[model samples]
Structure formats: C-alpha cells, structure tokens
Target: MSQKILMVDDEADLSKLVAHHLQKEGFEPLCVSNGSDALKALAKQPFSLVILDIMMPGEDGLQVCRKLRNKEETASIPILFLTAKDEESDKVVGLELGADDYVTKPFSPKELMARVKALLRRTERKESASSYAYRDLVMDVPRHEVSASENRVTLTAKEFALLEHLLKNKGKVLTRDHLLNTVWGYDYFGTTRTVDVHVRRLREKIPLLTDAIETVPSLGYKLVDEE
Candidate 1:
C-alpha cells in the first residue's frame, strides 16, 4: 500500500506541485492549508510522514510540531519542515522541536522526495535487538521507549536514532559526517551542525549522557564505552 503523507502549507500552488510529485512516487498526499485542518486530517487518519511549512495563518508549523510531539498518538510520526527560513537558528529551532528533517523553500522536488523517503525508511527500519543499554540508560528499540535511572525519557525520532547509533558504536570516535550518514541517512542535505544540535539535545534530555558523550574538538563526538 502507498504511504500516506500530510502536507501543511498555505501556498496552494506549492501544495499542488508537491502533491503531484508525491503521487508520482506512489505516495498518497493530503494537503491542508493550516495547522488546525492539518491536525484534523491527522486525527482522522494515520500518516507515514508530514511535510510542514513554518509560516501559516493561524498556528505555525513549529507550534503544530510541538503539539504533535507532545501527543502520544502522533509523537512518533516523522515531520519534515519545508519553509523559506534558511537561517542557522531557524534550522536549529526546528530540529530542537522534534522535526526529523528541515528543508528550506525553493527546494528541489527531487531533493524533497529524497528527504521524504529517507524519513520514512528510517522509521520503518528495524534493529536486530529489542533493546540497547549504556550505564543507566536503556533503549527499547521496537517499543520506541527510553529510560534513565528508571525514569522515562522522551525523545524525538531523530534524537532516538542518534542515541541508538551512539550506543551501538560506544567508545568509537564517530565523525559528524558518519553520524549524519548513519542516523540521518546518506541523502541528508543538512550540514554537520545538525549532528552537534542533536548531540546537545541528547545530553540535555538524558542527564546520564551529559558527561558520557565526549566531544572531540574540531572532530565529532564519542559515547564513552567504559567497558
């Protein structure tokens, strides 16, 4: 069955163009002009992914993303922000808000499709083990759950994937490029700063990881294995 994708954008022409490409790629695209209607569509049916625009009439894309991330039912759904805001701060804020990917406006349809496919692929991929652990932190892969010192820790999809990769390669110095390719997909168009943002978030979310994840200046990060 074709995957269902929800697109939230005020631009009618752009929405139609995106829908056309998504259909050609064998995806069922549903376009909504505002965040309210977008939420309505999402509540009405399940979607494989969401393409959201930052600027809107009522609630903006960032607000919508926060609501989705807070809701248990929609928290796990992957979100890609498509907007005209190309500033580094904007990208960092979107990523911090639980958006799996960010694409600035004037984007190529092909690259957009690539990002869409990458997000879906990441969500659908399965790990061999049911869970992974490092110190007091435990990650239940299939269950999509994480805990530190017996306290539940919530993480966005990208954050979860980032931590998963780090735990899998504990003690190894993973380059930003390597982490980006492995966790964000090789087709990811973002820069290494994306890795730094996520790593900072992970540290903030899981206190146990604050000091555990060592930063190699001018290089990348490493999750101390302490084995």
Candidate 2:
C-alpha cells in the first residue's frame, strides 16, 4: 500500500500544492484546513503519518500534536510540523513535545518529501532491526515475544514497548517524562510511578540485565553497559 499522510494547513493553496506533490511521489495525501478537521479525519480514517501546521483557526497544530501524543492509539503515528517559524527554539519545542520532524515555510517540494521519506524509513528500520537482532536477547515485535539467553520472557505490550524504547536508546539516560511521552504516546496521564512499575516488571522477566538499567532517582531511568 502507498504511504498514507495526513496534512493539516490553514493555507488552502499551499495545502493543495503539497497534496499534489505528495500524490505524485506515490504517497496518499489527505489535506485538511484546520486541526479539528484533521482530528475528524483521523477518527474516521487512519494514516501512517501526519503533517501539521503549527497555527490554525480553531485548534492549533501544537494543541493537536499534544492531544494526539497523549492518546494511546494514535500517539506513535509519526508527526511532522509544517510551519513558518524558523527559530531553533521553536523547532526544539516541537520535537521535545513529540513532533518527530518539522518543515519550515517556503519549503521545496523535493526537500519536504525527503524529510517525509527519512522519518518513515527510520521508523521502518527500527522495527526491522529489533526482529533481526544478532544477540540472544531476541525481540519479536510483531509477535510480541522476547527471549534472553534463549529463555522466553513474557511481556505485556506496554512492557515490550518500554523495553524496546530503552534498548534502542541503550547507554543513554531516558528521562521519565520522555519515556512517558514517547512510549506511552502522550496519552498516559499517569505519574512517573507508572514507568517505575513497568521497569521493575521488565527486570523481573529478564533478570540477567538487572544492573544494566539504572534508576535516576527523582528523575528517570537509563540502560547502560554491563561490566
């Protein structure tokens, strides 16, 4: 199937032009003029990615992004911010809030399409790599299976996602909020205690890596190299 993209922009002409270009590139583009409409579209039909304008009539793109990120079902869907602001801080805010990518105003169709492809490609690779791991700690994402040292470890969907997120960021400290936003998909309104619960459960299943994951105490958790 062709890649499905949802585009939210207040500018009618720009939205049309972008939709046309994306269609030509073998992508299925669905354009909406406002955030509410974009949400409506998503509720009615699902898409692989969303291209949102930061400013709009009723609900702004940032609000929509936040809402989507907070929802469990739609949170993992890739989000790309399309806006006129060019400040570095603005870009950081969007990414920090869970926007996977951003495109400035007056962007080239070719360049915009490139960003789209890159995000999609990276998501695909991550999905594939987990299943294709060379280590005995095997992860069958699609099948929801994990094995350490050739021993099977049962895990819930959330547990697996949390582990995948950490393992993918191995050797890095993942803040509690970051994990909540990324793994739980902005939908979880729970406290940091939620992360702790899952992490402990995950450790119980894979006891061999108990020391590999460290608690930040009053902060977050990190997966590090074992001695």
My TM-score estimates for the predictions, one after another, are 0.95, 0.63
User: Least accurate stretch of 10 residues (summed lDDT) in model 2?
Assistant: 125-134
Clashing pairs in 1: none
lDDT of 1 by residue, 102-170 (tens): 999899999999999988887774856568888898999988899999998888788888998898899
lDDT of 2 at 12: 92
Candidate 2, after superposition: displacement of residue 145 in Å? 10
Task: Supply candidate 1's per-residue lDDT for 175.
Answer: 96
- List candidate 2 segments past 4 Å from native: 125-140, 143-222
Q: Which has the greatest lDDT? A: 1
Best candidate per TM-score, number? Answer: 1
Native-structure RMSD, model 1: 1.4
